[model samples]
Target: MTAVQRPVPLSVLDLVPVSSGSTSAEALRNTVDLAAAAERAGYARYWLAEHHLNPGVAGSAPNIVIGAVAAATSTIRVGSAATLVGNVRALQIAEAFGTLTGLYGPRFDLGLGRSGAPAPGAPAPPALEPRDDEVVDGLLVPSPFAFRIAPGSRFALQGELLGRVPGDVERFDDELALIRDLFAGTYERDGQVVDGTPAAGADVELWIHGSTGGASARAAGALGLPYGANYHTSPGTVLDSVRAYREAFRPGVLDAPHVIVSADVVAADSAAAASELALGYDRWVHSIRSGVGAIPYPTPAWAREHPVDPAVAEAVADRVATRFVGDAGHVADRLAVLQRVTGADELLVTTITHDHAARVRSYELLAAEWGARAARPAAVEVA
Candidate 1:
């Protein structure tokens, strides 16, 4: 097949999920292996996501995982999908990535994000009810999901253990500013004027990640940094979030708007095979949305035997509906639409499954297809 030049580069986002019956040590080893595979597959970057107090997730510390991943992969850029600023201090963020840069020679991105909703107890503003699966220009634009923290969630415990007061979501702008000040050698830690040193002189990219068209978008725009919108996790409002970032953008770190949109995808030799591998996705999503953090990734048989409650089903419906699952051709078509619609400079592909081999194959198949797909249609403006 003749290869077509893709408009956008593709990257991987690793959550380092612990599969059912797998040990954390095994998960960590699997992550390093995956990063190596991604590098060989021609992926532009490999990022680690931070998740705390989750029995199913082993990447509670992305910076450390990044170091391991960087050591294993030769050329792929490695960094945080985002390190939640709420639980970590600016001094820690600076020194961690700075040290990584010193060791790895400037191939890092310090992606920052907020774990909690920026506005606490804020009511959704009245707006037109969007239809489900509204396809704009070929891209599927899902109806907005109204997210709320589970009342019985154990997240507060995670907060307490991390030395943060429970439910204390801080200002995203303040956190952004603090990171900037640290790198500029202006912020003081422990009453001493701290020099940016390694961090200040490091050649690392600063990125802001967000799920909605709110605080994170504005901060990234105002700071002139690159922004990543979470379409894979927050499908319903991804377009709005990207639009928010573009609209709020100002020339500082970057002269023009630069965006990367993410998607959940699974690819196989056939659509049915892909669907079979993706069978347990809903259950996996239910765990996170229910505030239990992620559970060990379940097997297809286990998911088939134990179904989620109707309420749980409803809570994760949008995410389930939006996931791109099919053969390589089909999945690539969907991602191409996503990239064209969002005007993304790059696309971040996240794939998860119980079998490690299956997960790795998904990326390899998608990369092959993405490289051979036809030119994307013209960009469509969202009315």
Candidate 2:
């Protein structure tokens, strides 16, 4: 078999939005426009994120957003950078993307996350609902229920349970088995149709997404899914989580275990311009450190006016140091190192710049930069 090339596919992790002063409708429109631009710019894929209760994050319903993006762009893939699986159920998710697949073909990827978006500074929840459960009758898909049926009586009685059911449930194996069976019934060979459409291809590429290791890696391995580590905001786990994923992986549907690391990136005409755009992200990070709610990207003037705490600013800088930034060449060099370090089959770039046009330009430049890097040979083995 031919070895996979290094400096892999460059993709965008978009949180589509208007600039700090723009409106929501405009943001949504801009998102569609941006996805189309990325497609034209030769980016491999454009993935949106699911963030709830944050005015700053416009891509809350990734599936809906993906639909818009996919519809607007012909060949560029559109996916969820990470969808909180706990908020949505498996059948719905399978159906949602299955429909997209039918519409867009091989250009859909499902990046699944377990935790909900917590307002910045909010404590991580005591418990998180896992993605695997979201697929079967175990956890209800996040969409509004189809009908007004009382909770446990209708669903549980019909031998279908959505969301967490109480009590002494079986172990992971049992849960996986049940989930598999349900998906099989809904989207497998003997698939059924709801509202007159067939359900098949639940075999969609499922990606395990997270900021940590252990359960996420083990679960993804056991289920034979791809894994994505959130290196953008959670840089510490970039390598360890990928290592765990590869070690725990067993060959199945995927030829081999693949890891995608998310990285924060900002590119501009000059180093000064890039750093200026990064100020918003730095402020966003500082707010996160102070336990303030997820704050909007500050204006260049605003960022300059309000200096962050020295410690907070340093912490932001350190985390972002792992980020790819600067003019195209500077950022591309960093991407090469990152792609080498994590053995990511793809690099998912997330830019936190508050300027809408700046954000779009940054991705366009990175896509062009990485497109050339992808042509060269580099070590593919995980470092």
Candidate 3:
């Protein structure tokens, strides 16, 4: 069979999930192995997300995981799907990403997001002063409902439930500016210039990730950086966020706007098989939404046997409804539509399942179908 020609490039966003009966060590190894498979399958990039205090997630430190994956895979771009910028100092991020780029060459990206993860018993970092002037002109005010399911809500709830005071989420824009300047070797403190050394001269792509069409989108547009909308996390605002990014875009590093949309998916040889693989998704989502950290990924049998409260079900309905689950062809068709609707330059897929082999197979099947579809011949010739 001919490979499907995709309308847009495809990439992977892995959480490095620790399965119901698996150890973190095993999860980490699985991540490296998956990266290698994804590279060989022709995926464009392999990114890991940052999640803290979550028993089910082992990607707490994305930079470190990125290094491991980059070393294991020869060509696929590797980096954080997003590093919570508000959690650490800008200089640290610069140095870390710089080192990765220096070692791996240009195959590294730095995708920054707004929230921070505070460790238990640690005081929250002080908030940077609000900059009214930082607001971009013509930016649309997002809907109130947008906040309800936005990624920030999850980050805030995670901190609250863990009894940890998180850093100022509002400081993201300022931090972004600092990081850019640091990377460019233009940062200055008082009368002295601050340098990021190896990182300051490293070549790395910068990206801004957001779930809402507010600050994050605007910031990316204003800076002319690539914007990634989190359709997987905030389905309701994905389009809005992408639109916002394009609207605020200015010609800078990129001559035009570029957007990457993320989606949660599960694919298999048969629809029934795919559905089985996605069975435990709702329970896992419920754990995160419930303000209790994510639990170990449950098996399909465990998810089916464990009763779910109607309220819990309702709360995670959006996420469950948004996830794409089907056989290869079905999922490939859906993703094509997603690419068209968002006009995304690329699509990032995040698939989680109990069995490591099944998870890898899902990506393999989807990649093949997507490639085939993209390369299909037109039915009729133009006159």
lDDT of 3 by residue, 291-320 (tens): 567888999999889878888786677678
**What does the lDDT read for residue 342 in candidate 2?**
70
What is the per-residue lDDT of model 2 for residues 222-306, given as tens digits with 9 covering 90 to 100? 6677888877765654555778888888876576887888788889989999988887666676554443434666788887888
Q: Model 3, 23: alpha-carbon shift in Å?
A: 1.3
The models' CA-based lDDT, in order, is 0.84, 0.66, 0.82
Using TM-score as the measure, which candidate wins?
1
Model 3 regions more than 4 Å off: 1-6, 116-167, 190-192, 378-383
Candidate 1 local lDDT, 129-247, one digit each (tens):
45566888877777877655544465655655666643335455776777788777777879997677777767779999998788789889988999999999988789989999999
Q: Report per-prediction Cα RMSD to one decimal.
A: 4.4, 10.2, 6.9
Over 4 Å off in model 1, which ranges? 1-6, 117-133, 165-170, 186-193, 374-383
State the lDDT at 18 in candidate 2: 39
**Model 2 ranges off by over 4 Å:** 1-5, 116-198, 288-292, 314-317, 376-383
- Considering summed lDDT, which 10 consecutive residues are worst modelled in model 3? 132-141
